[model samples]
Target: MNIIIDTVVKEYDNVTIDIDGYVPIDIKLVDSKGNPPLYWRVGDGSKSLLELAVLPENGFLSAITLVMMDANSIHKVGNNQVELSCEESGLPIVNLDLWKDSANNDFSQRFIDNFNCDMQVYISEDTILIKIIESDNVNWIHCGGGFYLGLNEEKNITHLLINSLTQVDITNFTESVC
Candidate 1:
């Protein structure tokens, strides 16, 4: 007797989907040798994990709280942006933008220009204002604003900011922080 079966495996690449009713839930950063670097959980229940595999040995990290949010309604920003209100004075808190155009993709500038709205991006404590000057021949995305935390001119602040915010178990922070 002989038996045979046919099967096919499907592979799907990760893509960014529009998040609805998402606010800022919590941000956590963790650093340890040979461990995953970053984990993010948005208020809309969207989540992602990023691993920095190429770091020096014996790296240690902890979450540094620059700002805190309202306790009762922690994750309710009306618009797509994760806006915040300052707890101290009841003022508007600027939400940090974490999205970036792919380095290999040259369509970012053109896309922004066609829209004609200033792209606001936040990295660490700084808000970056971006305007598309040209896209056809330029190789890099040139925009103004860098290093809100006031680092060295040559330092890769974007990388540091991203690393700091992305390395943690954010989904379980409510339990862990308690």
Candidate 2:
């Protein structure tokens, strides 16, 4: 993943903190009014502490880490929404805005907590890039997709454009998925 170090200051106090180049992702936090508060920021890329603490033996985020590239998209239930229609190819058209967040890493917990909808997590596997859809019960359902993780000409890590779920044949269910 590409690491671009950036700093953010608290909205109220302006206390700045350095976020070591985390990728920003757009997500919608659902509010009490059944509306999703749309916003963007660097997400917690590591496996959740809750997952680690609860399920020590399980690799809960292993599959997630695979499919979701650095610059991916997430949506929640709000205003000034950007429209991205999926083509017949079953892949969303590449839109850069959807991949970036407004505040970098200094995301607000209140904004997220106000939304009832769970955050969406995407992970690309060796071959299968899947969206880890969290169910009402917090169980995950794999929505398959594909993306490329590689180094660019400058030796900088970049996410190359790979196919999406519909384009990739993830049905093989074999070790050679990648």
Candidate 3:
């Protein structure tokens, strides 16, 4: 569903994070409040979570790595809070909607905490590109969406987009989902 903020159409195709390897996708998000976009990546749309990122409106941010746990379920609470939990624990692994009044986030911590390895961060085309180095030869990684991982076979590196693309709100998922 395309979110509308201040009567301005906010769609995913407007801002796309085109990386070198994987195919860029226009992220679909639901921003309840007038806040920024919230990206959730669940592995195969199953229980395992690959990443959960909150791009802080692309402004000032701290370099702190906030270690977050993987969650299975995510939902909005009272239109002001987001609770993510695993195994129906009734407790959220990480509760969002609390960072609204806080400072901006670099999202480096969420990468490290999710992958459990050291990663590089880069910002280009108004999106955060996370560089993860793996020794194994891998290709075609899909957790959130389709990814053509072998962008460079020699490098064997994967760069995941950490932010959402903004476009004019047009596509409606209520009738036919993309």
Candidate 4:
């Protein structure tokens, strides 16, 4: 199996991951002064994958480790949200604006309660799109997509698309090999 990670940024960065089977993943968080402790949770509707806790220090930054087994799980940690999907071919797209709505009246408290960490406030109505595609002959088990900000205002809305291919030997479950 293979894993792919993708990131996108408008005013802030957004990341997505794709994986096959169950795998352990490690994430890091920085302990910024005057900020609340970071926390993470994975859930599908009411089903949560983890309990809230302070991220552990792993070397330079705090880390959040998880062994993922489901593809439909959504992870919300600090100010970031992640989702996984399985796709064979073609381009996969993701939008980065679904995180928070600063224009809403309860945005402040809601954002604070969810992330439990300090976050920079940026009030701009912008949206970013990302796409991912397979690029090599090898069969890929994971894929990701994201975008980043640009220098110029005209170029500020950036789009990033990635294609990944793996060389892992694939096995068919139905065919019994001797």
Q: Per-residue CA lDDT of candidate 2, range 52-128, in tens?
A: 00011211111111212222232212221212222122111111222245224343421211112122323333222
Write model 1 residue lDDT over 1-178, tens digit each, in one string: 0001111112211211111123222222222345332212112121221111111122222122212122332221222222221112111111111213322334332111112212122322212111112122212211111111111122111111111122232222222222
Error of 2 at 132 (Å): 2.7
Best-to-worst lDDT order: 3, 4, 2, 1
Taking all chains together, the TM-score of candidate 1 against the true structure is 0.16
Against the reference, the lDDT scores of all candidates come to 0.20, 0.22, 0.28, 0.23
Candidate 1 residue spans exceeding 4 A from truth: 1-25, 31-59, 69-151, 154-178
Each candidate structure's TM-score, on Cα atoms with residue i matched to residue i, is: 0.16, 0.18, 0.21, 0.21
Show the colliding residue pairs in model 4: 7-146, 8-147, 9-147, 133-163
Full ranking by TM-score:
3, 4, 2, 1
Model 4 C-alpha lDDT per residue in residues 1-178, reported as the tens digit of each score: 1111222212211233222233222222223243333333332213222212231121111222333213222222232211223223222122212223422434332121222211111111121112111222222212223222111122121212122212121111001111
Better of 1 and 3 by lDDT: 3
Model 3's TM-score against the true structure: 0.21
Cα error, residue 83 of model 1, in Å, equals 22
Candidate 2, run of 10 with poorest lDDT: 49-58
| Candidate with best lDDT | 3
Enumerate residue pairs that collide in model 1: 30-167, 37-167, 38-166, 38-167, 39-166
